[model samples]
Each structure stands twice: as C-alpha cells, then as structure tokens.
Target chain A: MKSAVKIMFLSALFAMCCFSGNARAYEYQGVDIRGFISQGYLQSTDNNFFAETEDGTSQFNEAGINFSAEVSDRLRLGVQFLSRDLGTIGNNEVILDWAIADYHFRDWLGLTVGNMKFVHGLYNETRDLDMVRTFILMPQSVYIEAWREAISSIQGAGLYGDLGLSDMGSLSYDLQYGTVNLDSDKGAARLLGDQWPFEGMGLLVDVDQINVDYTYAGSIRWITNLEGLILGGSTWGYQFEADATTLLDTTNPMAAAMLQNNPGFVDLVGPLNAYGARFMLSPSEFGVETVSYTASMEFMWRNLVFAAEYMRTTYNIEFRNSPLFTTLEPVLSANGVAVQDGTIEVDQFSSVGYYASLAYRFAPWFELGTYYSVYYPNEDDKDGKERVAKGLDDQDHRGWLKDIALTTRFDVNENWIVKLEAHKMDGSAILLGADNPAPEDPAEDRYEEDWYLFAAKMTFHF
Target chain B: MKLRSIPLIARIVLAGIVLSAFGGFIVPAGHAASEVMVVAHGSVPVESLSRDAVQEIFLGRKTRWSDGQKITLATLKEGEEHEAFLRMYVGKTPHQFKNYWKSQVFTGRGKAPEAFTSPDELAEFVTNTPGAIGYLPQRAYQNQLKSFMIE
Candidate 1:
C-alpha cells in the first residue's frame, strides 16, 4: 500500500511537471494548489515512559507532508501524508491524515462535508498548518487514544457562520455532526493467496472506519463585539459528543469493550449529553507606538472535556443466561464466592471537567498562555483499577493535569513562516496511567509528570 | 592690545554687519504654515475639534458626526504624501488601519469605507454625496466643497 501511494504521488508529480512545461496551463481563477514538507528534531528530558508520549524523547523525527488545493472561492480540498520514528523503539508508520472539503458562503455561512479534522476551538482548524499555529503538539487533553480516530478527526459534515446582531455586536458559530469508522467487515475471501484481513491492517489503509459504532458531536459558538468607549470582545462556545458501538463481534475487542462498558449502548451511542461553554473578554485598545499589549481572561465550564465528564451516559446490555450457571450453580461454586444465575448489567458513567485560561499577546505573532483542566471518571466502576493501570482511566483522574505553554511565530517572508514553541506540563498522571501506576492513596501516589518538548518548523507556499 | 588699535566707527560697522547677517537667517522665507480643513458635500457644521477627535474621525474609530449623522470618509488610493498626512494627523499607518477594518469585517462588526484611486475621483464623489468627507493638498482646494475649520 505504501509503495502504491508513493508511486501514485511520483507519477502525478511527473505528469503535472510535463503538463506545465508543455501546454502552459492557465491558473484556475478561484483554485490554488499548495504543498509543504516539514521535518524536525526533538530532544526531551525523559524517555521510556508511556506517560503521555510513548513516542519517547528523540532527536530524530520525520514530519508529514501536506498537499492542499482550493476547489473554489468557497470550497477547499486537503491531503496529508505522515511518517515518524518513535525514538529507538523501532515503531514507525505512515498514514493518510485528512482528506476533506470545506465550503464558505458570503463569509457569514460556511459548511464542511467529508472526512475532516475536529474543530474544537481556534487551534483545531489551523493546527496542521504550521504557518498558522505556533505550537508543534496540540493540546493533549482533547487528543487521547481511548477513541483514537474520534479525537483528532471525524467523518461527517460541519457548518460554521457569522451573524451580526446590531450596531453594537455579532455572533460566530460552528456546528458539526459526524462518525468515526473504526473497522470494516469483509463477507468473503479473496481469489489471491493474500487474505482480506492482512490487506486491511496497518497505517497504510485510508480513514475507512469499519464498524458502524462511531462518535457523534456538535459545537456552537457566539462572539460579541462590545462597541463602546473601551472596546472589548467576548466569545462563548459549547460542544457535545457521544460514542456508540456493537460488541457482539468477538473479533473486535475495542468495540466489544465499549459496548460492555456502556450497557445502555443504544441511548448513549449518539450525541451524549455533554457541553462546554466559555466566556472571555479582551480590551481592544492597542497602546500607542509600535509595541502593544492585549490581555484576555476566560472561564470555561465543560460538562465533559475528558476524564470526569459531568454528563451521564446510560446503556442497556442484552444477555442470555448460561445454562451451566442457571441449572448447575453448585458445580460452579469455586473458591468461596457464590455464582449467580443470570445478571443484567446496567452501567451509568458520570464525568465532568472544566478549566480557566489567561492569555496575553505582546505582539502580532507572540503570545503566552496557560490553562487548568480538571476531570473525574466513574468512581464506582469496578474496572477502573485495571483501566487506570493501562492509562485508559483518563476519565477517572479528573484533576490530574495542568499545562502551560509559550508560543511565537516569525514570518520569514510573504509565503514562508517559522514557529517556535515550548510547553510546561504537570499533573494529569491518570491520563498517563500506562506510563505510571495508579496511586494507592490517590494523594500519596503524587507523581510529577513534567517534561519540556520543543519543535521548530519552516513552512512555504506556492 | 597696545600695538593694533582700530577706529571705533569701523568696529561699530563690523558689529552691525554681523548682527544683520544673523537676523537674515533668524527669520525664514516662503514659510507659510498651511491650515487644514474638514470638507463635506452638504451641511457639516464648523466645530472646534481636538486632535484626538480628528484622529478618531480619520481612523474610522468614529463613524458619526456630533449631530447624529453618518460621516462618509474618503481617501486616495496611492501617494507618498497621503501616508505622511495620515501619520502626521491621524497617527496611524494605512496598513494598520486596513488590518483594523479587516478584523471588523471578519467579525461582522463594521462596514469598510469606500476607496478611490485619485483625489479628483474622491472630490467628485464627495461633491455629489451628502455627508461625504475628504481632504487634499491646499493647492487642490475648490469651492464645490465646504471647508470645515478644525481649530
């Protein structure tokens, strides 16, 4: 698959060069094609820990290459190919990250439909574009392995727009609905010796989620410009999401585990009742002369931003009583515990998280920001211990992480940019449970998860 | 001092010549300080405005006059001196002002002012439209526009 993709890319490039050299093609009026290749190195203070980054601290990192084409004035198409080595562990893979299209209408209304990245906030849309965002790694809480495909991108449709209310203010909104395809099912075998299972495995396949079990989500944002003597702006956004799966297939354990966890699967499959809202205000006055400063304050309340989501997900599990357990209970009465005939398991997951961030911009391309996020998972889950041990209990340790980062961007030229960023991460060890053990006393197991990661990128446009 | 003694009248003449030479340069020639006027097509009353008020008007920070009327602001598309005018009077660069308006455009906060390529075009538009406002070099002054005295 990798070789095929590479061959296709090379042939396409050759054909494009030949066509350009011969026919002298005309530039598409509203269409544009841009591509970039960025590779960087990283050195971290820690290694061999699954904490948050199992990729380990390595000085050798091969970044991804992206190809984006503008379909029209209002629509856009994008493709990203990525390959990376996780330092000394011999783990590397290549995958197609995003293949999507975006649409804009009258600046006030926009829609995106296809397999696309999640637009959680200001960073989501511009995260992959090294030219736009100053950070190398995205905010980690929003990106987790629990639902690997669901966190970064989703396969669905999204809508975004702006609304002017009066002479005083206006609102901006973004809404999306989509599913993540985890696995596909093959009914029969192939003619060649090579089977379907091996063909569908690994980082080579497209974002083709196999199972119907998926995640659904939506977000609404409102921004207002307070036109007064002292100019100020405020924004509020809310996001809600839910996950669903069918666990009957033994071949798919992830799906089975999700179903088993959410016995009330049907009710919690789509649009789980979760929401996040934030209120921020920044004075619009940019002092006299060349240098200026802007300070902002925001308070966020997320019903579920991860870990302890305040929202409750309820599901029902269908089960058939085992004949041996029902009829021959005495025979199964091992070690001292008595066996039950048939048990119907109903599970309710209650989780919530919230945070506050303060950011200051010293210049057009420089900023300092900090955030505090807290979450709590289901305390009553009998499987929390094992899940936490495996770093799957991100939902359990609610108040375990805090992140601070300083970011800067330098526009080298009209079409090129260089960005530098550093991060100070602490707490949230539960989210990194795989790298660390669950604290016996919760407080006594206090482990400082601090690491400094830095990256520089040079981006160019055509 | 005892060896060389000059005539008193000759010394006085020399002192007078030096004073006259100094006086000639002390005052300048063709140095008329020009006065700027706030012009419009229709009725815009002449009112005393502070520099801050004029800065606000030119920067698009203030969109209305004191009498609750819309102000139509105009500008020439290109010129080296026009930028000097903005810098000296409005205290803002054209690029800075353009970016400010772009932000307002994206957030749907305000409408951008119309632009013209030449001063004659600006004058022509201002003459036919009410609440129209524009400025030009003192030499391009005309009677069709009302001169607003910003003193």
Candidate 2:
C-alpha cells in the first residue's frame, strides 16, 4: 500500500514537472490534479527545534497531491495524500490528508462526509500549504507541531456553509464530529507521557496506544461589513484513553535516598529503589479529556494582513499510579502523604497562549512578516514553583515559553516560493523530553532558557 | 488584414482563437478593446445583475439563479481585461481572485470556473451553455450572446 501510494505520488510529481506551466490541461476524468513539494533546513543555537536543530538538520520536508472533481452541480469529491518529515516524526509516511464528498444543498447548507480538515483557528486548515501563507512556521502557541496531526482532520463528517448578510457582509461556519487515528510511536503519545505525574516519582512510561473515543471541532467567522475585517471563534475537544509500558526506575540517588529516609521509605518497595534495579510496573489506566478554544481577528487591506488570536486549553485527567504497588492508601497512612486513594492527586490544569502578527507584501515577489507569541503550560502556576514542588521539573522556566519570530518570504514566481525565518526564544516550555532527555543529576541543565532557531525553506506548487 | 475587415461572426471566432493563443496580448499596435462587458447566455433568467450579485456568482456564493437554474461560470485565464473585470465587478485583484479559486480547489470546496485564454472562446462557451456567465473586452464585433448591464 505504501509503495503504491509512493508510485502515484511520484508519477504525479513527474507529470506536473513535465507540464509545469500548463498543468491546467492535465485533468483525468474531469478531475483536477494539484500539489506542492517543499524542502527546508533548520538550525538552532541552543535547543532542538522539532528536528535535530542543535547540530542542524535537513530532515524537514513535505509533499502532497490532491484530486478533486465536481461530480455534479451540487456534489463534489476530493482527496489529498500528504507525506511529511519533521525530525524523527512523520518520517515521510504517506497519510491521507483529507478525503471528502461534499453535497451543497444551497449557499447556506452543505454536508461533507468522509475525511475533512478540522478548523480550529483562521489558519489551521491552511497550515500545511506553504504557498498560501507568508510564514515558514505558524505561531506555535496556537498551532503546535505535535498536535497538528491529532486534530488536523477528522475521519467522520462535517457541515459547512456561508450566509450572506447584505450590507453586514457574510458569515462562514463549519462543524465537525468524528474520531482521529492516533499513532502510539508519535509525538502525541509522548505528549501524554509527559503529562503523567508519576514520571517524577521514579516512573517512566512508554506509550503503547491512544484510543480516541471521540473528537469534535467547530468554527464560525463573521466577515464583518468593514472591508477586509473578520472576527472568528473556534473550538475543539477530545476524550482519550491511553495504554503504556512503565519502568519503575528508582536507582537515581535522590529518589532512592528519599525512599529510604522518608517515614514511609523503608516500607514500600524499598528494594525497587536499589541501584540498577529496574522493575516493570503492572497495568495502570490513563484517561484524559481536553477542551480547547480560540478567539481570532484578522484584518487585511491591500497587501497587508494583521491577525491576533487567544487560545486556552483545559485538561481533565485521571490515572492510577500502580495497581500492583499496594495502592497509595498504605503510603499515605504511613507518611501522611494525603493520597485520598490510590490515584495521582491531579485532575485538571489549563494552558493559555496568544499572539499578534502582521505581514506586508511590499511587492509581488517579496513579503515580510513577524509575530510575538507567549505560552504557559499551567495558567494557575505562571511561575515554576508549583512544578518544582510537584517534582515535574527542576527549573522555573519550564512553566512558560515566550517567542518573537520574523519571516521573509520570496515568491520567485506564481509556482515557486522561498522563505527564511528566525525565532528568538525566551523559555523552554514545550521542548519534548525525547529531544532533551533528563539527566540523573538534578542540577544539570536539560535545556537553555535563551535560544535562537533559524529556518530556510523552498517550495514548488502546480 | 485589419480586424474590422473581417465579417462580424468571423472576427469573434478569430479573436477567440487568437486570444486563446496569446490572451489578446498582440493586438495591432494602434488597436485595443475598450470597456469590459459582463455577458451571459441568452437563456439565463436575469437580464441584468447588481455588483453584489456578480461578485457572488464569480465567488461561488450564489450557485443557482433565483429561477433555480444551475449557474455555469466562465473565466479568462489571464489578461488586462480579466484584471479590469475582476476589479470592477468582483471587488478583487486578479491575484486575489486567483488565490480564492486556488484555495477553494485545494480545500475541496469547489473547482475553479472553466477558464479560457481567449475572449472568443469564453464568448463561445457562454453562448452555448445555459445559465452561463462571463466577461469580455467590449469591441465592435456583432457577437450573438446576451449582455448584462451591471448596476
């Protein structure tokens, strides 16, 4: 199946190149064929930025092709196949970007079935299309790379339409409800691992599977009477349960010393904390529900576009630390640790992010854009004191990340684009643990607080 | 030979073929079409269109006429007349109009309108197709297609 798709993708690319300037006539069975290919390079002065950026890497690239046809006056069908690689993620895997059959009953009502793109903010649907935007990377505060695949498209169905408001301009809305296919070896699973509180309690987890019970996305935009002004609101939610393999690593000296010296220390599996002693934990259940929303505004006049958005995501999670470790009841009674039962004492936290951006196309060939974005993992714990007290991290900067980015885009022509971008980062909030693994020494710096990431990319579309 | 020297129908046909080949780019040094006209098929229900209606039709917002006939849209591939028509009637730059269609096509919303590189081809397309609408550079040729006076 993979090789078949690769062959089709390569065949389309070859055909498009041969008929580069005049691909408009390259239609099959009245189906229009269009796609883009992009290659990029990344180099970061301090931390790895999605890829192995510290040492520089060229593993950033994307290619996609779509076939669409208006099968009837009121119905259309389309599908796109995308393959992208970002660091160790994606690895150039062929995936269905979106496949939909749309039936337009009227201007104000339409039904889309099959797989459709999920709309979160103004730019989420277009994030993968490089020629459509001026930035190499979207503001990560709202469009995180790891979360892109998990919510980029839904496999069920959707409803979308545009309503005319006479002098009040118009309104466009989309609603989707469906399930998402999650990969266990992908970043989304690792992200869940990062959230498990027991990771700090000498427990390490490797995600085995993430079962998404349901996912939904909805968006509405008011195209105001004011020319080029649009105000919008969007939201998406998910209910998920994950399975994982856990390692009870208690060999670290601090964890071991705490286990041996604390009041409950000598009683509860103290031998598991022995040097080089690794124990495989028994089966535990992990469940999480997330609700995220964004309010957005964009104004476009002539060649200038200005946009601002604010997003907040709240999480409700529950987990059992160990089913076989004799429960938290015994430990709490011995050390007064306040574990109500056998569960990790966390149920909720919210993250907040927002950014304002502006881009100007000075000429047909040149564009410049910039934005400043700020994100906090825990809205209640703006400072890292709570994290350190909870043993989640050793440094305070892990609680927040702030970034200012600049991008220069050059449209060599209608078919080709080149871009250069630079980001000045102030914190290390969302850096993946896989990219920056923790060391046994608590005093060691896992990530630098201040860093810079540079990126250059070129794309060709037909 | 001067374009005026040809028969009316023949000129429209020749103009269409030449326009398809060169997008009306190589008109005689001293000759140029003046004023753009919004034209439609003779069977279309509306005799004229408001600017808003025109924009809606070109943007795929209004899919059918009030009388319930499906609307077929025709567009010039690219030319000065195309840019002028989009600016005057569609409230969009030629570049913006192209992007709008491209976005729609890629997103599975709809395919782009049938595009021709010649006015004659577009006129011919509009003439035969019911509920068809298009724009052309107004000239002195006696073409037999319904013309819409925009409000």
Report the lDDT tens digits of candidate 2 across residue range A247-364. Answer: 6677655456555655643444433423357556665667889999999999877667899999999999776555433444454345333453455546489999999999866655
Q: For candidate 1, write residues B1-151 as lDDT tens digits.
A: 1102323423433353344335434543222334335567676654455545555566544555666466777766445445555555665444445434433322222334556777778778878877667766655675657765554
Please give the lDDT score at residue A73 for candidate 2.
Answer: 81
DockQ of every candidate structure: 0.02, 0.10
User: In model 2, how many backbone clashes occur?
Assistant: 1
TM-score of 2: 0.87
Give the root-mean-square deviation of each candidate in angstroms: 20.6, 10.9
Cα-lDDT of candidate 2: 0.78
Given candidate 1, what's the lDDT at residue A151?
Answer: 37
Positional deviation of residue B43's Cα in model 2 after best superposition, in angstroms: 2.6
Residue B94 shift from truth in candidate 2, angstroms: 3.2
Clashes of 1: 24
Every candidate's lDDT: 0.40, 0.78
